[model samples]
Target chain A: MINNQFLVFVKKEFAHVLRDRKTLLVLFGLPVMQILIFGFALTNEVKNASIVVLDQAKDHQSQRLIGRIGASRYFDIEGAVDDEEAIEQNLRSGKVKMALVIPSGFSYDLAHRNKAGLRIIADASDPNTANTLSNYLSSIIMDEQAELNANVPVPYTIIPEMRMLYNPQLKGVHNFVPGVMALVLMLVCVMMTAISIVREKETGTMEILLVSPFKPLLVILSKAVPYLLLSLVNVGTILLLSVFVLDLPVNGSILLLLAESTMFIITCLSIGLFISVKAQSQQTAMLISLMGMMLPTILFSGFMFPIENMPKPLQAITNIVPSRWYYIIVKSIMIKGLGFQAIWKETAILAGMAVFLTLVSLKNFKIRLE
Target chain B: METVIKTHELTKRYGDFIAANAISLEVYKGEIFGFLGANGAGKTTAMRMLCGLSTPSSGSAEIAGYDIYRQTEQVKKNIGYMSQKFSLYEDLTVMENIRFFGGIYGLGSKDIRLKGQALIKQLGLESEEKKLVGSLPLGWKQKLAFSVAILHSPKIVFLDEPTGGVDPLTRRQFWDLIYEAADRGITIFVTTHYMDEAEYCGRLSIMVDGNVKALDTPSALKEQYHATSMDDVFYELARGAKRSE
Candidate 1:
């Protein structure tokens, strides 16, 4: 008999889902957009370089050298500066990635000694780009000289050995498909759960659930079950796409990956339930979920940026983001192929968070009823 | 008499204010008792306490001989309540709403389906079984809500202004259903603002500012106040209560 009520409630839940086209579009459209945007827009690969030139020698020869440097497809001419001080300030302020310092007598010396010196001061704050810059700069110079030497004699050949490490091909899908999956799961699990609970409260339907013969704990469980099921499907869809379309391998055990994702999704769901209990209105629920969960997850969960590079206090705060631990588990299993032995610590942390949040909300529900 | 509901000075206090003033009420096995009061007159609060949905500050209520304090589950099982808001899962259909209440009341699956079918036919909602309750007209929704409220056939059914927004014709139809339920020996304790509805009650209590102003049959209240109808008695009692303040 209770199955009928369950069926009725589930039907109503799905009805609200279908009737609200905008929310439905957001629920499905958002995940697709996140996958595509993260896989393409917020990719791990580097594309265009902005080069600022600080040329003290403004002669026609120096001008010709600058023109050749800008002609290369690798670097775009960001701007030109007069003195080294301006270049230093721009680099320090992160306005430009690489600054070319052409010496005052660059053309005059190249004519006599067949050797011209230039300093490429790249911002090393971003280590990958900084390392790439020196190699790219020398190649650009060599390429220009090679072009000059095509018709005449150039003193020596500069055979630049340029190699990329870690991700040599710079495949866009390598980091991003997994990142998109993490982002979509994080949003769907947390925001959807929180908003659904708050929607019940705002619409005065939650009171009916509370007054029912079911225990408050059962009520919470029932509320969470359908969402958990939906997220599993979403996780499956994401996995299928990444494997089929992007051709990424399931390097880790698929079982371990699914199990870890289920745990993390529950953790996110619990956090959302906690937020719903704290908020009184749908707007408050949404704002708290966005500002409290989404922003921190994007910033500190290693989904968009590296946590290790952040300041100390921020690193400390990142520990509290549930997405941070979940991100670690997903990345380690999906990308690194690390097994449970290495990922268990993060799994335990997420488990603790899920239990803590669910228990606390349950306590609040009973206490309020009392 | 086997009391279906009994309250001893059942009261609820909302910080310095008495929501349900110290007053006692009793209901017999098959009586249809009406509770009348103005808006925010503590009728709904008192009903909520009796249904074990709200806790009284200093007094106690027993539903079907079960003390509300210690045996809430038993009280919940033996009593049914329909809130003034016509509370139901609006996104669900008529069949779905009936099925939900029946299931929560612990009916078996076969019985739930059987009773649901019978109810849809009885309420003239057979054709509207698949229609969402939110999309249905208000009168149809009200009738369906009351049907679901009694789907479990509890010992006592509490209705809090169930016919408030419904039209007069629908209200008459609803009262006919209540009479039939009372005839079948299901005690009905209902609250209403309409004076004409109060006239249909075997007995009633009038509340004003959290206190019972009068308790008797409608004719008795009218005769005592030297008035023509329940409306006059209500106004007279209210004015008297106001003067006492």
Candidate 2:
């Protein structure tokens, strides 16, 4: 009999979710939109950045270097500049992101001194692009140098070989897919569940529910079940987008990834329950969910900002943010393609949070209308 | 008369303020017990306590032979509640609302179907059964809410200003439903601001400053206060109330 009641309750919750157009849009549309935006539009990888070249050497080596820079996808040689003043003018006007200066030493220096000098002046106004462009130029020059000395044996020289393990091409989508999954699931689970529960309070239906013979714990559980299912759907949507649309493959076990995602979803639902219990109105619940959960998930998840770079206290604060752990677990399973052994600690933390939050919220959930 | 609700020294305190002070009362089965009070005279608080929707600070009460504190679930099973705010899901269709509520109350599917059909027919809402309750007129919504409240045939129904914003005609029709329910042995415990509606009760309790100042039949209270109507008697008791909403 109780099972029948629970089914009926869950059915009603689904009806509530399906009947509201705005909620339907939010439940499905938001995840898809976020995935497309993060995967394609808001990428960190710099491409086709225009630069001005100052080739004073007017020699074969200098022209070849310029040709390599132009041929590479990272940069576009907008046009040649006569002097430093023209380079400065192009950079100041934001026409070019970088200025490549090959000093007049030409091929003569490399033949005599076995070394060549090159200068790169990048617009530092946007520091990330400046740093990345300079690094790309340095690597290209080093590649040319290595090729030139390929035939001649240089004695007693140690050359370090660097390889990026997971993402060879350094695709931005690989990093952001996990972050977006964490963000979308957190927002959909926490905000939607909190608002749905608090909406009952606002419309005064919670009083009727409280007075009914149904258990208060069941009341909370039934409210969360639909959102839990919906969040899983969201996870699928994100993964599908990442694999097919973003062309980022899932490296680890699909079942394990889903299991970890379910754990995180439960954690978010528990937080939503906590917010619903404490909030008197839907507006308050929404504000608290957005400000409290969303901000921390975005900032502390270490997907957008590296946790190591943050101050010590801020890093400590990130420890309690469930998404921070979820983010790490997702990257491990999805990007790094690791097994459970690699992510057991993060999984344990997420499970602990889910248990702790569920207990606390259920304890705080008032059986009375108070 | 069987006492379905009995309370003694029931109090609810919020730190320094007492929302419902120590009070004592008994309500007989099938009585239209009018719980009258001023704006903040604790009418809703007392009713909430009786319905097991609020815990009392220090109190002992028996609702349908179940302890209010220990067997709250039993107390809930025996009572129906409708608040001043419209508590039905406005987004749900009328039939859907009936089925949902009936299901939660542990009613059988057959019983829900029968009750839902009879309710829709009785309310003349057969055509609007599939329409969202949000589109219904206020009077129809109130009537529907009341009918849904008693669908399980509980021992008592606690209505906290159930007819607050309806017109007089709708309110009268609403009272008719109450009378019909009372005739069927469902005790009606209602709080209202309408003095005219107060006269419809079988017995009345007038609360002033969290205390039941008078408890008697309407005419008897009028005679004792030497007043012409329930309105004057209510004013005589509630005029000095220091609390205002």
Candidate 3:
């Protein structure tokens, strides 16, 4: 039987959330807007980069290579330069992002020695773009070489048959949509809950609630229920945006995703409760939730950075963040089409974190106002 | 008269410092008991202990005939508490606050609605019942908070400096509400810095240095201290407190 007191507390919580239009807007609007922005506006793909080629050879092979590079959508061949100074000037002036240098007798070297020398000079100022651009140019040249020698019998041609599975198109949106979903849900749930609960303290309403007939645990639960429901709606919004707007399909069971989302939402709500109980003011709660939870979730959780590529200490730190496990679970479920069996470990981790956080918050929550 | 609140050597200690020393007092039904003290005189600490918001370091107390320590739930049910700060949800409407507190106190929905409407009409907030509590003036908020605190009609209402800051007119009006509640047979246990307001109590206990320096009717305390007013009486009693050391 449902306690009427608990239901009334929940209703009051819902009324507080609905009455605050600004916080409500952020609760619902932030996830969809972040998904759309991170999906459509942001990308890591090499696309339409301007480059100048310095062909010292000026041979048919160099011209053919240039034509192939120009044909590829990843790069635009500004023009074929004759000297290194022109290429350097083009790169230094920011006119082109990369310069390809083909040495003299390039075709003769390929015919006699079955090899040729080429150099790709890129702007190292932006290292990520530089690395990606260099890889694209090298891959394009490799493809050209493979085509030219398709009919010929060579001693050895180590063709790397790179097959990008799951997201074959290598769409950046696929890599980021789930992450944005996790970050949005975590931020909203944790920050909103923390701030709202501390708001009661700041306004002195928390003392009244504590002195009421309802238990302190029930007070925290009522505060959490509203945010938990709002976060679920946020999950739906993010998923809808991901599937419809970004064209990212859910390859796994929708129910599993929802169930996992609910678990993750609880985990985040527990964190918010812990933060609120520790914080005395709303501003302190907001600060702790953002700097303590949100930043770490985004950075160490592999939402924006790969945990494997992080330094050893940072990788160790990522293990402590709940979002890392939740992010992996979401990626496995949404992208890899994995079932509960494949994601059980991560699901267990999230569930354990939820329990631990809830217990810690419950243990720390004092019924008295001391 | 039946004893509504009774305490024996109620004390609260924080580590080595004794915030509230061994103090004993009793409040009868329908009496306006004023607890007077200077800053850090342990008025709030003693009040918090009696309200079941804090555990005593040593002693026993009962509220509404229920033991404060063992019967905390029963004690909470029989009392209402209002602190100095604004306690209503600023974002919630006036009616919403009423319903929320009413519901939490286990009032049926029909009773809550009827009482909420009656409260709104009584406060002359009929037109502004839907308005957020934050938009109301300070005076209006204080009165509304007092009304909501007593919405459940408990045996006693503990007010911690309920009229700390407001205009003279509003402070006078707030006292009127307090008197009205007291007249309705609810024990009014209040703490205030306003000496003039202290005179309104049927009996007053002025605390100094974590001890009850004086407890008597306003006139009796004035005569005993040979002072012209309660303010002079308080100053004379608290002027030599060891806390200033």
Candidate 2 chain B weakest lDDT stretch, 10 residues: B45-54
Residues B43-131, model 2: lDDT tens digits = 98898888877789997999988999888889888999899999899999999999999999999999999999998998899999999
Clashing pairs in 1: none
| Per-residue accuracy of model 3 over B96-157 as CA lDDT, tens digit each | 89988998999998999998988888789998998989999999999999999999999999
Residue A181, candidate 3: Cα error in Å is 1.2
lDDT of 1 by residue, B59-104 (tens): 8777888998999888777777777776777877788777767776
Using DockQ, give the best candidate's number.
Answer: 2
In candidate 2 the C-alpha lDDT for residue A88 amounts to 76
Docking class for model 3 is acceptable
CA lDDT of each prediction against the hidden true structure:
0.77, 0.87, 0.85
Candidate 2 error regions (>4 Å): A42-174, A367-370
Q: Can you give the lDDT of residue A72 in candidate 3?
A: 94
User: Model 3: what is its DockQ?
Assistant: 0.47
* Model 1 lDDT at residue A187: 77
**Residue pairs in steric clash, candidate 3?**
none
Give the Å error, residue A356, model 1. Answer: 1.9
